[model samples]
Target: MFIEHPSQALNSLFRDKPYQGVNPEEAKFLFIGLDANYEAQIDAKPIFAKLREYHKDGAAFWRSHQVHHPFLLPQYSGDGRFYHRSFARIGFTPEHANQVSFIELLHLPTVGRSSLVPADLNEEHLSKLSQIVLAGTAQHIFVPQAVARLMHATGRFAWLLKRPSEQFGPLGILYRQQAKTVYSHLHFSVYGKFEARKINEATAIRSLISAGI
Candidate 1:
């Protein structure tokens, strides 16, 4: 696959600006989402600019960002509970959430509740995301089921999807690769109510732990 420079690719992911999480360079895991949800009209340029400024401080960026935007913190009373639980299941330490990066397939915020409107990204966007996925430092990548479906349907990401996947519990799928691992689970909002999958989730969690991810 033809690869573009990191900054150039990331620019596409965030609609012509490179936006990434705190300590992306050192992160061991990546939690990806479809897009941001907000009820107000937003201009993301300044937000990305602010993030770039805070991200320069590896020691303080995570906490500082959390202070300013408590909703982004995993411990907050939000969809992040899904991430917190999954991180624990993987035997990952929560105090080190800075070691995990958050990536969005689309950076634009949707009004009210988030939905799978686009379903998939265009070629230009997919090429950019592919560059990051192929070369980034995060060894473990997690995405919602909707995003996973998008990847599976897009030809640009076919190289990764072609690999056989292991069924992870009742509503998740896991793919192991030489350099990284990809796991797709139910959307965070629905995850809490999906009680029927609990037993299988435990077994899958143990399998994931054994995989050394």
Candidate 2:
């Protein structure tokens, strides 16, 4: 959890925009599942850095912008590891309570006795996650289903494959497209491909609100 000041160019790219009447407190919590390997990469640093910068900015941008609701990083340390250690606890003070909390799903280290086990969705941790969301402490959960699936297929989480395509815009574009064919089964509002392509941070925030996340 290294925090870096945003450069002028980065600041200009994320300048605050006019609010369309959306309130931050009322905004839905967006839980973002970051790929561990992807996050470790040098290029991906900017994305996380930008997210941190946006939250620290604390202006109108804070009002309209949705924080990465509960940042869940997978744990990858310790011998005979059975659980994922949270990065929030590893890099930053775990006591800094806020509207959002990030959880890191720890993975097994490469040199460990065994490879990282698949995250147990049925575990008490997940039950607690649901409780946290139900308590209004959390808003919405965003898991990169594609990345999760890939991780399931392969024992390792590949960073390059998990990186979002900036050639488009906010990573939500990829989610929106997939939401149509596969995600539609979840019964959430299915914004069409045309609408999905237009998603940005603001639009994603609105969608989370509209979806009742």
Candidate 3:
């Protein structure tokens, strides 16, 4: 089996916030996913691959490359073939990809051929994940409906999404808040009435945030 980011894996197990340098307030949108695409990430993008090699020396490399810090993230080199297009559904453009905030539920990239989210994800990984995500103060937070379900199954952070108030703001939106976060869910990466659905979701999110509900 091919070892992917052997060094990065070691670092994540120790680092509570593997993505340390990014500030939640700076992010326009906080995107949460189960993990990363290791094959496409390490094999195709030299800059991202640096996460593996650089973290071994401490967080220098990862911090340097963070998109929101001082630089903009160009579309990943292999974006057309590798990166998912669903982001466009949520108002993220190639330009916004740089300011794009990301939090992986599991920081460890799966080894060769292993699925991203296993049936039994490690509890330690899940625990820190809750902290990293909850600590963020982003105005908008999004995760796939699938991710909501999985988190619910574990009974951990599901409470974050349970309350939706009838008190909608100007644009006909409703929301529920948790600590520093204002979050909602959608069918991420599951294609359907692509343009229309995203417009609706984006509108609601904007309204909710603006209303401060």
Pick the TM-score winner.
1
Instruction: Give the local distance difference test score of model 2.
Output: 0.30
Model 1: residue 44 alpha-carbon error in angstroms: 14
Tens digits of lDDT, candidate 2, 1-213: 222222433333223311111222332333333212222232244345543443344233233433221122222222212111211111212222233333323311012122333542224433343343334333343444443453344433232234334322243222223222111111111246533432343344444434543
Kindly provide the TM-score of model 2 when superposed on the true structure, using C-alpha atoms: 0.28
Q: What's the lDDT for residue 5 in model 1? A: 23
Give the Å error, residue 14, model 1.
Answer: 5.7
lDDT of 1 at 20: 45
In candidate 2, clashing pairs total 18
Candidate 1 lDDT over residue span 1-213, tens digit each: 112223432234445333345444456666677764432422233344443443344335545553323334443454334544544444433355466566566544344454443443446656766666667776766676677765666655665553336754553445665877676655544555564454355456446446656
What's the TM for model 1?
0.59
Which digits, one per residue and each the tens of the lDDT, describe model 3 over residues 1-213?
A: 223455454446336444423433355566666654444434435445444443342224334553222112464444222133444434433344324466665555554554444445667767756655656456556666555556766677754554443422312112344444444455444445555665566666655445554
Cα deviation of 123 in candidate 2 (Å)? 4.0
- Candidate 1 Cα deviation (angstroms), residue 115: 4.3
Where is model 3 more than 4 Å wrong at Cα? 1-17, 20-28, 44-100, 111-119, 132-136, 162-175, 178-182, 203-213
The better-scoring model by TM-score among 1 and 2 is 1
Task: List per-prediction Cα lDDT, in the order shown.
Answer: 0.51, 0.30, 0.48
Which candidate leads in lDDT? 1
Clash list (residue pairs), candidate 1: none
